[model samples]
Target: MISPRPSLAKRAFDVAASASALLVLSPVLLLAALAIRLESSGPVFYASWRVGAGYRRFRLFKFRTMYPDADQRLKDLAHLNQYAAEADAPEASGEGCAACAALEEGATCSPVLVGDGGEVICEAEHRRRQNAGPAFFKLQDDPRITRVGRFLRNTSIDELPQLVNILLGDMSLVGNRPLPLYEAEQLTADGDGARWMAPAGLTGLWQVTQRGTGEVSPEERIALDNTYAESHGLGFDLRLIAKTVPALFQSENV
Candidate 1:
């Protein structure tokens, strides 16, 4: 899993390169912040819990691409999505089926979002989670993305702020895209999927590859991600990074 550990050179390169990218990307970050402020009535940066290496938790930073409190609404709407996926999977193949089924079953107030203590934290997190709902894990025609948000996502500006997460050592520049704690928990339940040893990334092998069009099942996505995790090395990471370049510029991810 994750080849036990990255070589010293790879680790050094990841940290050093991430630090360098942060400086180069600062101007773009400022512009993104200003754009968010100008177009939306909410805070410029949005931070949420993401599962990372060793299943450790951290705040994932991104430009505010949706309205505030968008996640909770999804919990309210999970049933509808499940119905649609179930209907479509018989024709489309059973990719996200099991994962979605598992997820939809637990749409209650998740402990990760609930914070360390009581109802107030839980309720507060519920609201924020609801706000982030429209763009949850897998999406098609999400209603929560603001007009500007759509533009930002299309041009990849929406993910730029995640560079900050890279700098804080919460993630890697290339690896698996971090899942929200709930999704990550579900993804790893099938132990030693090669997923347990990896950190969440700004972009990853799965994003560049399996993030292909259509509602990719979480099961398939995890399979691909774990495969990469199990085999990742300098050469493989280099190849994933090379593929990511075009995905970044291509607009259509897959």
Candidate 2:
């Protein structure tokens, strides 16, 4: 069974380590903030809703890596999503199937509908096609990243602000990485939910384990998270933290 609360020792370590890191990294944070402000005309920090341990929602902080209008541009860039198989799949042309075309604009051929690549799909075929992959959105060469943002993402300087999250008890130095609401929502349906049994974290098992492995499937990533959740403790946390430094300079901009 998952513990209802973090171990006292683990919590103490999270507090001390996060506090000390914030103190030591304050100047770096300030410089990063300054760079972001100078490079863009938006807030220096970006806070997006993330689902953490026990499905608690909180704003996850990061240096503003994308432009102010990044959210609005996401639909246009959906084809670039690395996790979406829809990009490679053949798309329906004209008005789509005769059954769907006969239905109203918002109506579906079946009672249950799935939206795949802007088209409403019948439930059975949708499930078959959707079994192609996970729902996580990622891009190999995202055009949204600002000049300074690329540097921050590559070096993971963008994640520095999350120390404040750890200090606030919303996260830990070592645990499963918190997921965006959309991503978390998808995981709630099955054994995949086991990934969230531990505290949310700044650096975790999958980040270190998949460091130079190019890209990991969402299923593989969740399994790593579940592994950490099942075995996490002070000793494991320290070991993972030690592995974190080398993994900081990641090849992927995620």
Candidate 3:
């Protein structure tokens, strides 16, 4: 278990700060949601269950970035992305909460739009491609992004709904970033599996350190996250949050 977590004052600060952020950012969020629905047919908000504090699971909200059935397609490709972590760490896989993990390979669906009156858009599970022939794994630059999607992601506007997670107490303003179930399990064998000890956050130490850095191996990423957890405190949280400001302007791979 994590030796100890942030102090009550810090935790309270996170709650108050996130709440205030949500209130002030509400207009921006609503506008973004309207843009998403205009260009796509999916819901204004895309909610996925992500690993959270205390190793718990919580639905994370994001502006939809892919085709609606992306979940099913992911399901079909499960073996590869699942065991993709490594060959020997463990021989088991957990069923993803999203249907993407269940869709079979070779299945193809015509491009569909998410909104009624916007740009042409199609949400696909496999649109991770750039110039065809299998898509690239990306922290950013997904080929499937719509014109508006591109703008939203680059500006980090797509993450606005997460303010709800903070309000619900399912997330924090600063902490380790959350992981997909598959990524969580894969990192387990990579030196204590940093995910096991870290609470999912909207921002964290890794976010700041990794800014302007090149492709990071999973090992290095885990190390940064663990270090944050090891020394977390009220002052440290404030420091990291402050650092994240300038880091936000830096172009990160994600």
Candidate 4:
């Protein structure tokens, strides 16, 4: 399916906002680069392959927040993933959840299931079995994060380099957050590929609404991304941008 064209006004806003921010924050960006260099022995920036609207691939830039060998260490730290541990945990009834049921039946399970009580139930274990891991991985205290990395991640200074992405038309200031290659693959396998129709951004509805909260599962994040893709407009984008500022100050870092 073809992705909808972004509004010209939105593109105009992205250009203006990103350019102005980069120009005004040049000194701060430089200092961040220097800090990363001083503390690490690798490139100052990390360029990750990300899936954007229409499954378009692009390099998303961020100030390096982890050691150079961080990716290599992911397998060794698999046990430390909070989501993975949750999936492995016994349910309240000391039985397996939907994920286990589906896996036992040799069938795929939905990423989310709504209980009769309206609680969001996750089938992360099923996803892990099918996709080899959770779509969204977060560790509360990852050993891979350097001292400087933690501070940069907490303050979100590491994200400043994304302004260049916006300026280059690779992303917008307000849209659905781009997914990493691995995460995108799982979402596609689950029939949630429509979410990729949304423009990629540095901040979006999910980030503003559920930032730093562990309650939101990967399925919920995909649902929110699809919802924004379907309903977002100039007014909604502006509102999300307004909310993002305060959301950043929240104690949780997801």
Candidate 5:
């Protein structure tokens, strides 16, 4: 099925806003780039694959916020992940796996891995889940973050480069936030993958509402994204942009 395109006005706005921001923030962006270089030994910019609107893959740009070997160190730091405890929780039997179970009543629960004959789970499937990270992963005191990284994260200066994404028509200024490849894989497994229909953006309903307070659950975040997908328009987008400024100042945003 062909994916629906974002509205003409929305696309136009994205181009205009992103270009204006990049031009206006040129100095700040330069300073951030320099700081990242001075404090780190890797490339100043960090680009990672992300799933954008309609499940399209695109490279997301950000100021490098972790040590050069952060990806290599992920496995070692898995235990420190805020989502580790929850991901490792005992598999939910009755209600927890209800959605998956409803589709196939006698199917072994994916999380539990047990079956009628003590059958082993598929190795590929198991590894996929393991590598998919979590529904949400945020560390309040992540050790991988550099000194300059912490400041960039706190001030959200690191995200300025995403304006380039917006200008490139890969993202919008306000819409549902895009997901990393792993996170996108997980979201696609959920029945509510329709949330991916919305244009990916730097600021969105969840970011404006949660503002890194970290109280929002994974399900809730997806729901918020779906809501925005269903209801968002130019006016709503403007309102979200207005709210974004204050949300950026929230202490937890760091």
Candidate 6:
């Protein structure tokens, strides 16, 4: 089982660092907020429900990086989703494997899975179907982003407001990133859920590992998150923070 409470050193560091960042970056925050407001007709800050450690839900704050109608515009841009299923992928027949089908009674697929329509599927097929699409949605050159928003995203200034979440003990300076509600829901399986073992954070292993390599597959992202969850500590977090400094300047928009 994952520990819900972080070590004293980790917690202490998060509190001190987050508070200091918020104080020192206050001017930048205000400027970003003003820029967002001037460019769009919505709240300067956006708060979306995110799942954190132990599957707890909290509102994650960010400088608004999309137009007010961004969510409404999502459906129109489904084709652009970087994680969407490939158009040429073969259809899943949902048929039992030959071995399992031959057994007629008693035995079943060695590793079984339940599907969305309440059907049982073998592991290989289940994995194939799952890998056919990703739970998280992201897009490169998303049309919903404003000019100012694009700058903020490129510089990651939009993520600075999450310092408040860290200050409030809702996150850490380094841990697996919190997931949006929809993303979190799709990650409930044991393999995927392993990511929830760590506290949510402003940045973490996957973000740093995938830096500048715009081709992070969903499975790879989750594997990195699981790695961090299994091994993060005060010293490791410090190392990640140091690496994060240089990563922040990378041109990769996501």
Q: What tens-digit string does per-residue lDDT give for candidate 4 at 1-254?
A: 33545788888988998899999989989988888899989999999999888788899999998899999998888878877666555444443465455564444456665545765445553333344566778788888888888888888888989999988888888888888887777777535876777788888888888987757777788888888888766788999989888888876675
lDDT score, candidate 4, position 228: 87
Task: Estimate TM-scores for all models.
Answer: 0.73, 0.82, 0.71, 0.84, 0.82, 0.85
- Report the backbone clash tally of model 5: 0
Misplaced by over 4 Å in model 6 are 86-133
**Rank order by lDDT, top first?**
6, 2, 4, 5, 1, 3
Model 5 weakest 10-residue run by lDDT: 90-99
lDDT score, candidate 2, position 138:
85
**Residues 1-254, candidate 2, lDDT per residue (tens digit)?**
78525789999998998899899989999999999999889999999999888888898998999999999998798777876754233324334345556777777666456475776576534654655334578887789989999999999999999989988999988888888877788888567888878899888899898977776877688899889889989899889989888887658654
lDDT of 6 at 127: 58
How does candidate 2 fare on TM-score?
Answer: 0.82
Residue 35 C-alpha lDDT in model 4:
87
Segments of candidate 3 deviating more than 4 angstroms: 1-5, 73-140
| Every candidate's lDDT | 0.65, 0.81, 0.64, 0.79, 0.78, 0.84
Kindly indicate the candidate among 1 and 6 with the higher lDDT.
6
Task: Return the top candidate by TM-score.
Answer: 6
Model 1 quality (TM-score): 0.73
Give a tens-digit lDDT track for model 3, residues 1-254. Answer: 46334567866987899889888988998889888888888887788877765567778998886667767666455445322333222223432112334456533244444434553333332222121121113424444567777777767787777877877777777888776665554455445455446556788887788876755555566678778777776788888888877876766635
lDDT for residue 30 in candidate 5, whole number 0-100: 92
Superposed on all Cα atoms, the candidates' RMSDs to the truth, in angstroms, are 10.2, 7.3, 14.7, 6.2, 4.9, 4.5
- Pairwise lDDT winner, candidates 3 and 5: 5
Over 4 Å off, model 4:
1-4, 90-131, 189-191
For each of the candidates, give the backbone clash count.
16, 0, 18, 0, 0, 0
